[model samples]
Target: MYSTILCRTIECLTRDPSQNRKGDPGVTIYKIELLKLQETIPDLTRFLSDSECQRANRYHFIKDKNRFIICRALLKLLLAEYTALDISQISIEVDAHKKPYLPSHPSVYFNVSHSLDYAIIAIAENPVGVDLEYINKEFNYKEILPNVYHQKEMDEIEISKDKYLTFYKLWTRKEAVVKAIGKGIDNDLYKISVIDGSHTIPSSLVCNQKNLYVFSFMVNHNYIGALALTVPINNLDDILFQPLPR
Candidate 1:
């Protein structure tokens, strides 16, 4: 069922410009196919910090290690483009909650997320969080849904015929919200309500007295994604999906 939904979503995303959503002026998004970038890892390694290199080496699987290196290297490359700073000079620091940030360029905000085959980054002037998830039909949602989802959200999923799609949509939205707030999974997912129509354009979400707007979309059909931002949703339109240079 998810595969079917993915095909339809991809078709919608690839539709003619006249039929699709227009680009947003305030937000910039970049999507990279990790598998395609693997060959470039050797060359991209030069941009990674010593700590990053060590972190990458800690991953037991060679594929996982390579993905980390590529994601970090690509993130630095993208930040350099927007900040006009040298890639080697850009420094990343994490908050107490573990959200990464550019210490040297505080005004430039960004968030990154990666699934099995892709990595996505979102950049904006204000705080932002982006999430990408591969729809897996094999996972057991019944046992996990109750703990992770709000009662209302669980009810929606329970009543839906396509539980898998509904679960990912709700999961991504909640994760995006928490990420945008830099709280990670420590915050309760139930507190955030991102059900279908409720989070329409210009939606208002109050987190720790700070308001945010969220936007959700499909990534190449197979993946579900969402972006949470401190700015207005109207400032964001269709995501500008660009490929990573090899």
Candidate 2:
């Protein structure tokens, strides 16, 4: 079931920008298994900028250091692939909210998220945000449910047969929307209502003054993933999923 879709994968837009339901915005998501990154790119540091290399060294733990290095390298590689630019030509900067962006290439928007051993990178022509979380079945979601979800959402979760699944699905949506807005998550999470009946369809909402469309999917049996786009997408087939070779 879910395991079948969890391969080292990248979800891409199958349709061309001209065929988009809204404006010409093409969004693609790439899922990478961090543990296998080094084997694929032995010298990831070569792809990273000097500042990024320094940041990688700042991590006290080796695993954390490797994760940062691998993620950045993969990002640069993917950006290069999409824009037909040299990896070194792509310069990344962060906004006041700490959202990373391409200072040189504003039209190319992207977001990155990783949980446990996997990382998901989403690149788009329009503003976009993505989140991937390893669903922890043992987590005591009840302890903070009220603080994070709207009253109606909490009621829906409480009444749902699979509370954990419901919580993660909704939680990922909130995270995706917040990231898409390019604003740091402050205290307004509970105000965002993401509990629409069907999980298969993209839902529209206005958050932090930005209109967004969010869609959720399972990365694997243990992980839940979501994507947020600034523009609406009428058909699910517009988004395509590709699994990287193991």
- The candidate that wins on TM-score is 1
Backbone clashes, candidate 2? 1
lDDT of 1 by residue, 3-98 (tens): 000001111144433343455456677788888787888999999989989999999999899988988898899899889988988888997878
Candidate 1, residue 159: how far the Cα is off, in Å: 2.7
Please give each candidate's TM-score. 0.85, 0.82
Summarize candidate 2's per-residue lDDT along 1-246 as a digit string, tens digits.
010010112244544433425443377767788887766555778888789888988999988888888888888888888888898898889888788998878888999999989989988888888888898889999999878987888998989998887888888888887788776565767766677632221122233343556777877778878887777555443344444422
* Predictions: Cα RMSD each: 6.4, 7.6
lDDT of 1 at 183: 69
**Model 1 lDDT vs. the true structure?**
0.73
Looking at model 1, which ten-residue stretch has the lowest summed lDDT? 1-10
